[model samples]
Target: MFLLMSSNSHHWNLMAVASSSASPQEKYDVFLSFRGADTRNTFTSHLYAALCQKKINAFIDDEELKRGEQISPSLLNAIEQSKISLIIFSEGYASSRWCLEELEKILECKNSYGQIVIPVFYGVYPSDVRNQTGTFGKVFDELEKDRQEMLQRWRTALREAANLSGFDSDVIK
Candidate 1:
């Protein structure tokens, strides 16, 4: 049986919930998806540290994927293996193609394996993500027209993730 968190009255019983059908092959409890340039030194770092303090095995690709135009296989595997995916939508998240690829894979896993996906709007509005407005839409404008199909996939993933129940850092702080 694999341990999972179950919510009760906004409280999570981290150790109490178990899933017998959950994959034993899962190496991580959560897969973190974020733009390093935006949150590597600030929010993402502290969030990762806090998860570590709680003994939550979370995956954050800081050094492993420093120089890649495409999302690496190992990073995709990390997303597939995790029970939950936490997407931190910052100012530049939609600017990176690599980040968009990761987001697509996370949503795919959510559909196929029943993986949980949570979006954290960090200094960004959910409407902006869903509608691809502001910086999010500006990045799409800069992309080549030849990659229209891929662009559409990324947009759908962003919209879907933005619609989920999640924390808005702006509201919390």
Candidate 2:
């Protein structure tokens, strides 16, 4: 009877784990989000290399993805497969439509998949990202002028992402 109970418990545990796992299975441990123009060569590259050195599977988009009218399918696939998102907020972050789209997708994953999100205020202030002030404010103003329909969505995404617990790059050593 004791042996039978132990075998059943182990089987149940395996079933529970399988049921709770991600549907498509996560491929990368971390997803790096940033303005390539701002940090691709410096902060982002260094961070990616560090993660790699530590044997952490990180997805950092290598090619310039911003030029495309819409974000590539592969990028979206990468985002969906990532377990965590690290958003590196810099001065020009809010200026690009592509970055904004990525932010929206990341937040969506946070809600749907329980994906962890960590924002990094690289050169800009967190308040700026949260409130859309300074550079962020200017960028939004221009975006709103051009694409009025998308303004609220982008703003919400910014506010939502900024509210999460994250690091201020200036404070880091």
Where's the lowest-lDDT run of ten residues in candidate 1?
1-10
Off by over 4 Å in 2: 1-24, 66-68
What would the per-residue lDDT of candidate 1 be over residues 1-173, giving only the tens digit for each residue? 23344445534344424556667878888898999998999878987876777778889997635554567799999999999898999988888888899999999999998898989898898889999998867875676779999889888999999999887766654
| Estimated TM-score for each candidate | 0.85, 0.83
- Candidate 2 lDDT over residue span 55-159, tens digit each: 667899888864648898899889999888889999999988889999999999999988888898888889999999998788767764777778889999999
Question: What clash count does candidate 2 reach?
Answer: 0
